[model samples]
Target: MKISAGMIVWSFCLAMAAGFTRSKPDIGVPVALAYFKTNAEVFASATGELQQSIDKLDDDPASVIKARLALKNTRLQYKKIAFFLEYFFKSAALIYNSAPKYEIEEPYMEYREPTGFQVIESLLYEAHPATKKLELLQQADVVTSSAKDLNALLYGFTANDKQLLESIQLELVRVITLSITGFDAPLLKTGIAESEMSLRALQTVLQPFREKATKTGVEVANYLSGGIAWLHQHPDFDSFDRLHFLTNYALPLQRSLQVFIKELQLQLNTTHVLNYEAGDLFNPAFLNLIAFLGADSSAQWQIGLGRRLFFDPGLSGNNKISCATCHQPEKHFTDGLTTSNAFDGHSHVPRNAPSLFYSAFQYRQFWDGKAESLQSQVKTVLFNVQEMNADSLALVKHLQQDTTYSKLMGAASPIDQIARCIAAYVRSLNPRSSRFDDYIQGKGPALSEDEIKGFNLFMGQAQCGTCHFAPLFNGLTPPLYDRTEFEVPGITRTDDLLHPVADTDMGRYPLFPMDYYKQAFKTPTVRNTAATAPYMHNGAFKTLEAVIEFYNQGGAAGLKLPIPNQTLSPLPLHLTPNEAASIVSFIHTLDDAEPTGLFIKKSNQ
Candidate 1:
């Protein structure tokens, strides 16, 4: 009498497939909400059954297999409505699941807890059978509750037309970028199948638009259908052509859908999450910071005043020092030193000076991630004894005496205004173009063949993109750059090639002592890495080759260091010499933007 979890999911998918593509007679908020509520119960039901299957697991091989299949089915069911779920009800979506190689933090949560589907998937898909059965049960319970919450949210949800369209567009992005890139199903490699289901759901969403603009709608539908069919044909995700998918399919679809939106006369809505123009994929507006700042933020008079303060030595203890002392713009805002010389010149700064280019784009700042924003990071450098070694009050007094600074900066203390201006200036350094970015935006010849190959390896075999992620090539996980991600990469003190010095830096642990974060540090952007090295938080490697080798050997695990929770896989990547070279070539293309002169002044000048 009991229905299997697979049966439950299949039935729902079949129902969705049957009715979803029919071009629902009515196309409005109430109808969309109604359609969602009608189908929402199925998602919760499948998840509950999945939890039960997981709880029933023990020594039996059959039971373990059953649990795994149920997990897969439950995942597919969620994919059915992932777009709408993630866009409107993000808070509830977190409880359900998230992308891999990243940690998420919710605003109201007391403390960060590793709960959700991916955590369960990791345990289920482990090489060895589940050892911690109790932990699996707990996670399954959380999934069940999260699903129930999602259904409740759906019942109360009232999405406007613009919001609905925005969700559809964002979903397409998540599909090709995150889903197709094999980000969501890291352990299972089920991205191909999951993407198919997601695309099928996408087809249903577009059916309503077909009523308004038949030709544009048909074009979008063809792209979606073709993309889904392509995914099915190329089942082997390891060899999947992500570039082709992004450019030929996903990019075209985005443009077509934009036309459809215009034809329908729906007001163009923008979101801070993915405010990119469908005209190009590499647009900087894709970045949350760029979206928040807008195109005109850089030209603000406050930012202009901040630029002068950055090069002025008044912010430092001695009039001889300035923000540019260590952060040279010509060197991509880095000093081109392993550890920069301190304001006193005798001592060295504790950490390597980071690039200001795209520095303000992240959710947090600094290698330790102690500073919450670009302004706070500036505050730390200005006051830290090893750096500027200046007092805020004294600096304010000194800046106030400067007639130009006092006149340009408003009523706020010169120091505070300077920090804000500096922050704005940093944000203005955001890069919208790179050879690799150009390639993604459909200029295929922008990157060399080897560099393109290397990019493929980085995303797939090299495991670099899993942490670095796309676009930013940093720890800000896509679909939503809401929280920052830090990892215990176990970077040694030096790249000795042999007898490498062990990394003793207790990253993030000083702030909150969690076992996993012991020696964990923030993952900075690899964008200008070829220029920004010495690499890692400690400046261990002098060259990109050495850095690649360190990761190839498997981070702390490869070094035989005792980091139980090292996020990086210790297993050797088995990358050939050419593969590594190609990766370096790809990284080389990340340094595309030229240095703007405003932040590039020499001390003598």
Candidate 2:
């Protein structure tokens, strides 16, 4: 009795199912695992066969079309196998790793039932028998050369909704045609191949019940158009930092895609929403949103608000001081005094108000790095008895009554929203196009000989950029918001006319409670460092030269300021005074021409 191909396929499927069931240790393991393992083997075999056919075609022109068809099939089979493997791995991983106990309240995973290992094992075994038949079909699809036969094979893959496989088939055809035609083909075979690939891939990925072709085509077209537009807008694509762009765009795109996939999953009652939109995936608008969200105009508003909040004496107990009394923008956002003069008139704050420029990049705020975020620091300054003696709730209420603040806080959450907005504005205060920016951007003439020498010293011998970093020249990590390392350089204990505080502030230790953070402070941006006077956590240094010299000698002698975990180096800088001065000159080059609207006076009531 001869076995028909259809009967053989059915029998092989049964065997695969049996294999799946036996392999699973429990009933809960997916049967898809069996299918994936079998498909991987089939794909591997097809790839091997296709390579042989390609070698034969290179030696024989008559067989080119036949070889190309075989290659297409091989590619398609491999892609289908690869796609399923990816799906299986991702799904299996999710099942194996349950949500953390603390994250039980998370909205997305809250409803998922506890999956048992036994149940998983049973499902795994049930899917095993079908694997053999699928593998055979995949192999057959790869070696076929007849256009009708190839189309039929392709249709089957699409019917299974394996879009990535279809796309791979299209890509293989395009490449094979290009190789044969030498870029001068009259028919532009590659274009036809691409169109077919797109159509098939889109069809496979879209919902089985929907008008797959039309809807998928529209989505693909839109994605392509958006990509083209983005490319046009950013013509110097090679110059733009790829990692930086990707890092900036990744979060927003991930969030958007997750939301989209969730919506589709709900509509289809299937877990594989990404598979449907696989061929038409990108986030053009999210990328565009980056620029507007971090622009100078926004920064201006933030800086102005910071200034207003800084100077508003009403926040203080005596209504005689504000943040600006210490951190004056005119003094590069620092009071000229060594230590900040607080609201109690004669009481001096423990540390100086560092310059606000490029501070948005720092991990922690304040000279002691007591606040983990800018918002926290703002709150501290507003509520501290020694500074602004205002209650946060009362401050919010007071601001709500003011027409100016009321208008600014319109429809926004009074406290958190306002704090975030102010932070947003501050983060946008990136003063690019400086001499250093010009130098980095290839405008070589922007920096003078001394300044250029200074830049080299800072990055090399001086090792400033190691802490300050590039572009923003602050504590910002290369492409993300990882906190900068804090350092403690011992300052001399002083007895003053006002509030005499501890000689050593213990910087970030009190807030972080980490041993390493003791006496550590966030590294301030070097941009506009020249203008901000009286440096150091205690505001002990009076000049850039003084600060540079202090670092040159490696903090205070025998001060036991532990080797900062994130220090640029353990070795002393050992810079000559002349080199130090050169670095100072380079630091001076960071000052930006003051922008308008940053210093607008409040309307006289």
TM-score of each: 0.84, 0.48
Output the lDDT of residue 182, model 1: 64
Residue 414 in candidate 1 has what lDDT? Answer: 60
- Quote the lDDT for 295 in model 1: 23
lDDT (Cα, tens digit) per residue for candidate 1, span 1-605: 99999998998899888865454333656556755665567788888988888888887888888988888888888888788778887777767775333443421113445667787877776655568688789888888877776656755445567778777777876775677666766666777788888888777766666765488888888888888888788877666766666667777887788777777777455555565454434556556565432222555766776677778787788777888878877788888888889877888877788787767667668887787777778887888888888976777788668777765446546666667777877777776567777667655465677877877777766778777877788877665565567777878778874776677888788876767667777778889888888877766689999989988887767788776677776667778899999989989888856745544566533
277-385 per-residue lDDT for model 2 (tens digits): 3211121121111222122324555545655655576656666766566656567667778777766677787777777766654555665555656667666776788
The candidate that wins on lDDT is: 1
Model 1 clash pairs?
A: none
Q: Any idea how many clashes model 1 has?
A: 0
lDDT of each: 0.73, 0.46
Off by over 4 Å in 2: 1-310, 392-397, 408-425, 442-445, 479-481, 490-503, 557-570, 601-605
lDDT of 1: 0.73
